[model samples]
Target: MPDWKTTYAHFLDTAKTAYTANEQRGDLLVQGELALAKVTVDVASNDITNIEREEELTLYFQMKQLLNILRAIYNDQFDMQPEKEDALVAAVLYFVSPFDAIPDDAPLGLFDDAQVIDFVHEQLASDIDRFHHEM
Candidate 1:
């Protein structure tokens, strides 16, 4: 397995580039999120026995939470620091790329995504808690 840190840095760079492209990046964020959901559903419905059901469910929950936060920020319904917003978007952009650290076809591929989301979740813990409370 390669170092996830290097892969994560690459994701961050990709995200920054896409984010500043003068497009409707918020729309891109939503599309990226929906893609992740569809992929997860496809993986879940398959009969791959080695999958850890509990962990996958937990990852799905985190993905939903991140989407909610990003939506709230873009909709002007929630307040978060600028730095945290960058981290959140970077994590979401990981999904938009068809290429993964491990291809999505692998039974455990989403775990790489899980790693990014988990790290971002921790990074934004306070904001997430506040978002839950205030919004």
Candidate 2:
């Protein structure tokens, strides 16, 4: 198996490149739809009782919110610059990807997802905050 950390790092770098290019060449909306669908299914299939720690719960919620924001962007409910849109799409792709730094079934696996979301959120904080205000 490939090193998960290396894969994660490579994806991040790809996201950065996509963001800087400010072009939407790939099927970002399609990817976003698939990612959101998986997230919705995961949420519906799993019970919240397994979450024991407050921090873990917080991370879960944060990822959910990030996903929602990405969905809105994908659905054209919110408009953004090409760069921002590309960046957000890249982040969502990372979250939906299976080859995470930690497997999703592993203990605290979703933490890696949260970290990726946090990184993206930090990068696009201003735009996201503005969108929230507009909504």
Candidate 3:
């Protein structure tokens, strides 16, 4: 697997490229990136020694929420459209790998949700048709 920095850079670059051609396509990519970032921070920041079992459950729940949001963002692009299953699965994995960017146990885990969100918004600033494309 590629390093986190490389993976995130690729994601941002790909998202920008996609957005330039299709706003909706780009927005979906950005949403996925942001969602991954959110989960990464939530998981990486917890004090494992102090982490409660319930917190683990909550983390899983939050992760699922983020995934659902991503699915919803791409539902239109996916719905009723025939596409390569491998490509679709690969895309999802690409967006998600950022969560595991740094070793979870590393002290001062890398990446932050705020930074990721800012990156997504900045990268997609000029084009927001994707946001409007949804009903």
| lDDT of the candidates, in the order given | 0.73, 0.62, 0.43
Q: Whose lDDT is higher: candidate 1's or candidate 2's?
A: 1
Q: Give the candidate order by descending TM-score.
A: 1, 2, 3
lDDT by residue for model 3 over 42-123, one digit each (tens)?
A: 5666544445434443544433433443454455432321222222323344444445455434543333322333344344
lDDT of 1 by residue, 1-135 (tens): 555566777877766666754255677666867776775775577554545666677677887888888878777798777667768788787755556676656767777877888999899989989989998
Show where candidate 2 strays beyond 4 Å: 1-9, 12-52
What order do candidates take by lDDT, descending? 1, 2, 3
Which regions of candidate 3 are displaced past 4 Å? 1-5, 10-69, 77-95, 98-101, 110-114, 125-134
Q: Candidate 1 regions off by >4 Å? A: 20-23, 39-46, 49-51
Q: Which residue pairs clash within candidate 3?
A: none
In the predicted model 2, the residue pairs found to clash are none
**Each model's TM-score?**
0.83, 0.60, 0.33
Query: How large is the C-alpha RMSD of every model relative to the true structure?
Result: 2.5, 4.6, 9.6
